[model samples]
Target chain A: MNVPLPNADHLVGIVFLIMIGLTITGGVIACNANRLVRAVAGLVVCFVGVAGLYYFLNSPFIAMMQMLIYVGAVAVTISFAIMFAAPEESKKHGPPGTLAGPFGLITAGLLFGGFTLLALKTDWQVHAKINDGSVETMGKLLLTEYAMVFELISIVLLTAIIGALIIARRGRSS
Target chain B: MEILSLYNNLNTFLIIGALLFSMGVYGLVTRRTLIGMLIAAELILAGASINFMAFNRFTAPDPQVGQIFTLFIMAIAAAEAAIGLSIVVAIYRNYKSIDAEDLVELKG
Candidate 1:
């Protein structure tokens, strides 16, 4: 193998920064877009950026699921709903309430500030890992330790799909 | 140089999670439509998942626990989106509009 360059770490850092920028920018677009379709597009972008962050966090499995589920399934579903609902063009431009915009900004800002302070100030205790959180370990745990939760999630998904179909099908003219 | 190694630090991930959470809150509060609110809710869930994974990587003794929890969260979020979108569709079918302001039947 060729010798690694000293500046390779810096390049990785730059890429991380770029991913952060992508996430924040996408989030801003998702929140501020006037068109619902545009907002969904922003959501897809934000999710992709988040998947990058997951890769950085050392879990490629979760990252792949993030992209597959959030970007592929969820975003597409939202867009389809938008197409079905057919929101009026004129009404889609305004905030929900008169004070909602400023009040929301203030509330979110305060939350962000508080969380940042808490994260920075508190000394979080780190513990030694019993096993590497690799894909193999995760698979075993899902079948063994987390089996109950896994089954419960499947049940929830089943109910959700059935409920969604029923709800959407009700009051149809046909 | 320190900035380059920021990914190894826990605080960096925490701050990113906070940012995503706040953006989601803002979107949820200010959106004028149900689907918009749902999108924001997904952002909120994403932020929570990030925090969980971050802690899983950095702090927790049993690293797999947080991953499992995050996976569970994703499952729940998918279910929520399905139900919510269907509800939005139903409301639209009845009202012929999905605007949050127009659904004020109980606005006494």
Candidate 2:
């Protein structure tokens, strides 16, 4: 199967590099933006880029789910929260503390750089695989091996739904 | 050394996860409002999910394990967001402001 592998591989590599850049840039924007709503917008951009990376990782199902849940549902919810609660000023910068803002930025930057160095320097081992991580295999394993977790998550979701209802409704009475 | 090719490696995902986690941590520490903190918490959950997915793709005996675990994390994060938002709503009703600085009546 000597099918001119380098060309295809390099193309994929370029695409992957672009996706990684998009994700990192969006994340930087999300964390560092001056306005809260713009930060939320950056988060949506980051999530969409991460979904692209998931597709590159050979799990299209997870990638699609990532888009649906994070970009579609979660981002919308966060934007709604912003609309209702966050400040409308586009250039408020930050809170009133003098030293806190710069200190927080430097701390986050250091942590990110340290992690990048560690990840680049270390050698990782990949062990044998039981399955190829396909959607069919994922479904079978979910139903067969992780059934208990599936049921527990359903319960958790139900509780969250009820709790959200009660908490939001409590304000209506007053 | 093809280090820049780190973009194609599993460790790249791990490093990205760590970056996201630290951003979340920074946001959690610095945000003045409850909803902003909630957004940061979601970022932290996302970082954890990315780690699980990366390990699943690279090292695990059963690759589906990580995917399943990530799915569960997503469910949990959604639930957490719903509950957290509701609480924020209630707190806003009670306090008239959602600023973390203002909701300090319980402080001694």
Candidate 3:
């Protein structure tokens, strides 16, 4: 096939690779950091990268939601929780179990290897399109086909907020 | 060369999802505190969402389904983080420590 030398696709691919790097680095920091706040920061970076991935997957709406929900709502909530409840440095000096870290690493590596193999070997099937999966169609489906779930999720969020308030405010009156 | 074309391949996304999942597993297993575990849980959710998005992009007939599913996952994750963090606060209040190992009051 005729093509330009080092085309636009190559630039997009390099950007994709950079996103992958950012994602993995964020994940590593989130898991391996010495402090909790740093882990939350890493989680934010990772979620941003994942949002970029969603954009590449042809779901800009989902990407925006990922950014709003994960990076905006979830990460911020986790950081607030850390601020309120994280243990002080002075209390963390006790010796930890020696085997826990190494064992966890080995288990994660094995799991990763198995999953990679499964993903590579599996013969995924493709089907004909019902719709173009556009924003307008998604909105229609969300209101029509998936209306019940949409409503239920709202209820769930309401309950979560209420429950969080009750639980966090339990001991404050003393 | 051909390596740059990896972005269009489903396998690439799947492998990335697997790696994210493994990182979550490692964090969950190794983290000593409840918030740390929660962070890892979010990572796991993210990986699952990526897998869904990949399959949606590559194979699904109704691509909206996976996007919708991923949105639901995000909603659930938001709820989970809220409830979990509140519980974490409660636990810290009761036990004065957020470490998972310190939560042995019910071990008997």
The two-chain DockQ for each candidate, comma-separated, is 0.76, 0.53, 0.71
lDDT of 2 by residue, B1-108 (tens): 254355457888998888888887787777777777777787777777888888777777767777888888888888888888878777877887677778788485
Give per-model CA RMSD. Answer: 3.1, 3.8, 2.8
Ranking by lDDT: 1, 3, 2
CAPRI accuracy category, model 3 = medium
Report the lDDT tens digits of candidate 2 across residue range A1-174: 866555655777777778777777777777667777777887887887787777766667887888888888777877776666655535334763676667777887788788778877877677655345477878877788888888999999999999989987855557
**Which of the predicted structures, 1 or 2, would earn the higher DockQ when compared with the native?**
1
Model 1's number of clashes is: 0
Higher lDDT: candidate 1 or 2?
1
Output DockQ, candidate 2. Answer: 0.53
* TM-score winner: 1
Which residue pairs collide in model 1, if any?
Answer: none
Question: Once superposed on the true structure, which residue ranges of model 2 sit more than 4 Å away at CA?
Answer: A1-6, A87-93, A113-122, A128-131, A170-174, B1-7, B106-108
Cα lDDT tens digits for candidate 1, B1-108: 788788888899899999999999999999988888998999899889889988998898888888888889989999999999999999998888888889998377
For model 3, residues A73-169, the per-residue Cα lDDT tens digits are: 9999999988889857324522357887888889999999999999989997745443354799889989999999999999999999999999888
Q: Estimate, for each residue in B23-106, the C-alpha lDDT of model 3 and write its tens digit.
A: 999899888888989999999999999999999988987778899999999999999999999999999989888888999984
lDDT string, candidate 1, A27-46, tens digits: 88888888888889999999
Regarding TM-score, does 2 or 3 come out ahead?
A: 3
